[model samples]
Target chain A: MAALNYIRSNEKKLKVIKSNSITFDNDTKPMAQHQLQPENWVDLYADYLFNYAIGRISDSEVAKDLVQETFMAGLKSAKNYKGDAAERTWLIAILKRKVIDYYRKINSNKGKAEVRMNYSAQSDAEGDWLEEQVADPFSSFENSNIENEELGLAIQDCISKLPKKQALVFTMKTIQGISTEDICNELDINPSNLWVMIHRARTALMDCLNQNWF
Target chain B: MISCEKAAIICNKAQYREATFIEKLKLRFHLLMCKTCSKATKKNTQLTSLCDKANLHSLTENDKLKMKEILQEKD
Candidate 1:
């Protein structure tokens, strides 16, 4: 792009861009490239890895197990560490694989039988969602002055009620803000199935909130 | 111009930043003329924020310590 080329050609602008792009924990200070310290790995990255795993899988115990497994794998494979990415980034990559493996194992054991919802039931002959069904009384609920704690719990309750596939897609896409391509690849779902799953998840949440909160 | 049903699908795609540029333009035009769809779109955005605010937590400190011991044992 012209803007990229312009920034590249301008020495001062390039320096500013490079400095701003250095995303370290401290302000503008690049991460220290230290050797992999296995002892400090838990203190340094346990919370981050835990949160990442918990977000993907709803079970806290399972998340803990996955993070522990990631650390173990990290320790065993420490010799292969190239120090290319940030330590946190490398740890996160390992945790992600552990999560994928968890899902793969669970699905295989369950025979990949997913709870499928009839999408057509939500719509009419004209393809519009049935008006009676899509009652969004609290359209302004997000921006309203409602207590976030209560709202958050209510939302979590709603999510916990959804089917496994819908919940996974919804959590990954809407909550985690992961890319569709990555979510699809991770879940072994196609683009259309991803959209359908998202649609069902949202509809379920909407209905759940309407019934309970609104 | 897209139908309300198509617009609704596109709106979800837009929420995920999966909508193409042309799809985005079409959705914008549809939203201007369609109140119901606009409401649905707004609710969709709110759903995301609410979940984010609820902010599901990770393992507790004790759990982390237990897991750390497990990792150490595996090492």
Candidate 2:
């Protein structure tokens, strides 16, 4: 615990393991450590971010892009990596916003098909959950409790079906164990609105699981 | 409406084992008077437990590699 008390000109002071071999870091710059080792950020937080991206973008490629984008953006602004929160939470907060940005961009693409995904019916997010033609894969859950196996599949499927934004909210709050406030900051939603979206997502997913998984 | 929402709330909380005495009371009272709500509540509880026990994540190897590359890539 005995070390040199280094006072960062950034005004935050913490312990430093001082040595005679210390070379003066010429840069009066901030966030040098994180910027120099961006890979370490992902090495530490990639699984968390990747799961989140899958829930939101639903495409491995796009999710990859978003995670990369989140990391790149954070690196460029490492000055903002203030130690006020856990670095994982802070990095994830960045990724959540990235997900919302993707959702908003896609929600406006006029030429895209109006789609309802059935996670149980197909692996792709746009596999079409039309009322006709497709033979609803999860219809078997209606008025019946699940026997086994099917129940588990149904839950996974319902989570997959959740829309990008709502799913992000629900996943961060429930799946990844991020705080709702962090979710709100990342998603740019108010507390009540976030709750409603989360509730609706949960309700819909629960209904889907009830009808399909159980 | 009250019966369904009340039961849903109680049932939802009960799923997390966070239902208050009054929540239990509402669910019980509603169940005593309405068979449909009672059935729905029972199913909700059962289904919620099933969900809590289910493994929602099933990431593939590609998923992990993509994640690793994302994390390790220089910002």
User: Top model by lDDT, which number?
Assistant: 1
TM-score, every prediction: 0.44, 0.37
CA shift of A153, model 2, Å: 5.1
Residues A174-197, model 1: lDDT tens digits: 666778888888879898888877
Q: What is the lDDT of residue B67 in candidate 2?
A: 55
* Candidate closest to the true structure, highest DockQ: 1
Off by over 4 Å in 2: A1-154, A177-199, A210-214, B1-3, B57-75
Per-residue lDDT value at B19 in model 1: 90
Per-model chain A TM: 0.45, 0.36
lDDT of 1: 0.73
Q: Looking at model 1, give its docking quality level.
A: acceptable
lDDT of 2 by residue, A39-101 (tens): 555444554566566655658778877877877787777776655445665777888899888
Superposed Cα deviation of residue A51, candidate 1 (Å): 9.7
